[model samples]
Target: MNVPLRDPNIVMKLSRLGSFHQSKLSFLRSFLKEFKDWDYKRDLFELNEHGYGIAVYSFKKKNRVYSLICFANELDENERSDRVIATKWDAAFTLFDGVPAKQDIERLKNEVPKQEFGRLSFKELTLSRANKSVRIFNHVVESLSKGVQPDRELLDKVGYLYRTTAVYGSGKFGLADRFRIKDRKEIYGPFRLEMMLVYLVRQFTFDQVNHVAKNKNPKKAVKLDPEICRNLGIGNSTGLGMAPFIVNHPTLLNNWISARETSLKKIREIKNISNEEIELFLGCLKKSIKNITSWNTESEYQIKKIKSLLSDLNKFIMYLDKEFNFKQDFAFNEMYLDLEKNYCEECIEYVVSMMMEPFDDIVTPLIQEMSSEEGKYFNIPTERTVAELKAILENKYSEILNIDFSKKENNLNFWFISKNKEEPRLANRFDENGADLEQPLAIARDVKKLYDLLSVSKNSWTIAKFLSTNNELRHVVRRAFIVEKFPYSEIQDNTIGQEIMPIDMLRLKLSFFGALKFDPRSDKWLRICMFQGAPLPEQLKNYDEHWVYN
Candidate 1:
């Protein structure tokens, strides 16, 4: 039996996209799978008693090597901040393309810590900076120095010892442009190098904490248990800087959503399900609930969503355990329909992620398809008639056309780049001073304006002639043509609406990064934990493939 892919109109809405969860196709999980057989090593470790020095970790297979050079620094309590404007952090790092020599290390030590002000060479693939969770870091050090493990309750509450505020790659700063390394077979997936940087950073936290503890008390200090080490992952504090990424990279975003929808469609088409597959699906679903229950957040918006998700998940579990039958034909398809009819969007998406866990064959191949050559779709088809562009807009942007952009609430917010950090920011258009310089991120509003103009123009006029007259809508015109081919390319909602939750955009991107336990601090920024339940680097070889659910 063939099952239709979920409608892009329904799936591309910000709320539904925001409800997405990490699956087998998440870049981090796929990164681990790709590098599992490669050699893993701590190539360099030269830290002082205070854990203020240089460390290096590498993943080498044959002649290729990607080394993560880490520099741990001592920062006073007042110097540490997670905002993008902050200049100092507890640690800074860069993933070197090849192994670094003594001179290279010295060169990076000076610049990596300087962060945005520092210049990096093409040898650097990615640059990032992290601040320690001082309270948690100090508690762990004190506990380990006394020959005791830190409180698991405290560890679980915060989830990581350090939280990176930014991870930069793809020509940001002076890092190597993606064109230089895009052909690498191992890193064909999107953000694989970024994932590597964060995963290695996780190990650095463990090594740094252990090193500091041993130095505090050499006699009684004990190494942190490997189990505890595996439980702690790296944390990230993300802000409005991430929102523009999805809007600016339309083809890349479509590839991601397309891969996901394709995986779901293929899984739903399976007619016969084995007992093992059924057992695996149910087991993962049951075990993953711990992730939701332990999720700590102060934002009432997130709190309410979590409550609804948990409540709906419980109801679905009860139905699955009591009424569902594995013997039924196209069982997953039935399950999906039932989920959409009865559960909330959050629960439906949660179960959608779980469904992929039991079917690696369906998801593994799609991982490579998530990256896009966006340049191929950039040029608008100006040769087509004006009528063609109007029809594409009307069909592809049905819901978007209905939005009343003239209303104050519809045009309430504007997105602009900050002068200080050169990062994306959102503000009220009426109250703020920079609406005139607003970025072209309001796709829905602009598309509606394009439609109104198109409705008044002659149907037979070519797009080239129309664009020659109305050049202001060129960006949306380019997007409209692209969206005609890529259904999930455009977000089917008003981005500048007053009720917009910027964190929803962040969450959409983070979910693809395999982040868990999203803790939104506000509508604009959030904290997330990565690799919390993942295997340690040493255990990568011969590790359980489904360790995420373990």
Candidate 2:
């Protein structure tokens, strides 16, 4: 039996997209799987009593080596800030293309810590900065120095000792452009290097905390238990800076969503499932409950969603344990339909991700297809007639066209780039003064305007002729053509709407990164944990693939 892929119109809405969860295809999980056989080492460790110095770590396989050069600095309590404009952080790091010599380390010492202000050569593949969770960091150090493990409760509350403010790659701040290393087989999946940087950073936090503890009391201090270290992953604080990425990378976004939809379709098409697959799926679903129960968040918005998700998951579990039978044909398809009919968007998407856990064959191949050669789709098909473009817009952007842009609520917000930090920001169009300089991120509004203009234009006129006069709509015209082929390419909602939850955009991207425990601080920013409960570098060689649930 063949199952149809989920409709893009329903899946592409911000709320549904925001409801996405990490699956086997998430970049970090794939990154770990790919590098499991590679050599892991602490090539250099030269920190002082205060853990203020340089450290180097590497993952090498055969001739290729990717070294992470870390520089830890002492910062006063007042100096640490997670804002993008902040100049100082507890630590800074860069993933060097290869092993660094003394001179190379010295060169990076003066540059990596400076972050955006400092220039990076092509040798640097990814750069990032992180601030310590001072309260948690200090508590762990104090407990370890006193010959006791830190309070696991406290550790679980805040999952990491350090939280990176930003992780930069793809030629940002003069870093190496993607073309320089895009062909690397190991990194063919998106953000593999960025994952490497964060994973290695997780180790650095462990090493730094241990070193500081040992220094505080040489004889009694004990090493942190490896189990504790594994549970504590790196934290990341993300802001609206990630919101515009989906709009700017239409083809890439489509590839990601398409891969997910395809995976679901293939999984649901399976007519028979073995007992082992059923056991694995059931086990993951049950173990994953801890993740939901322990998900701590103060944001009422997130809390309500979590509550609904947990309640629905419990209901599904009761049905699975009591009424559901694995002997049924196309069982997953039936399960999916039941989920959609009974659960909220969050629960349905959550179970969809969980369903992929038992089918690596389906999810593994889709991972490579997530990255896009976006340039191939950039040029508009101007040779086509104006009527063709209008039809494409009308069909591809049906819900978008229905929005009444003239309503103040529909056109309430504007997105603009901050001149100082060069980051994307959202503002009220009515209350703020920057609507004139708004970025071209309001795709729904602009597409509607384009449709109104095209309604009266000559149907036979070629797009080239139409664009010659209506050049302002050329961007959306290119997008319309692209979306004609990539159904999930365009979001079906108004981005500038007054009720828009900007965190939804960030959550969509973060989910692909394999981040968990999304703790939204506001509508515009959130905190997430990565690589938590993942195997350590030393254990990667023969680790359990199902460790996510473990």
Task: TM-score each candidate.
Answer: 0.98, 0.99
Shift of residue 159 alpha carbon in model 2, Å:
0.7
213-267, model 2: which lDDT tens digit per residue? Answer: 9999999999899999999999988888998899989999998998899999999
- lDDT for each of the candidates? 0.93, 0.93
Compose the digit string of candidate 1's lDDT tens values, residues 126-151: 99999999999999999999999999
Each prediction's number of clashing residue pairs: 0, 0
- Indicate the residue-level lDDT of 469 in model 1: 89
For candidate 1, the 10 contiguous residues with the lowest summed lDDT are 1-10
Off by over 4 Å in 1: none
After TM-score superposition, the amount by which residue 121's alpha carbon in candidate 2 deviates from its true location, in angstroms, is: 1.1
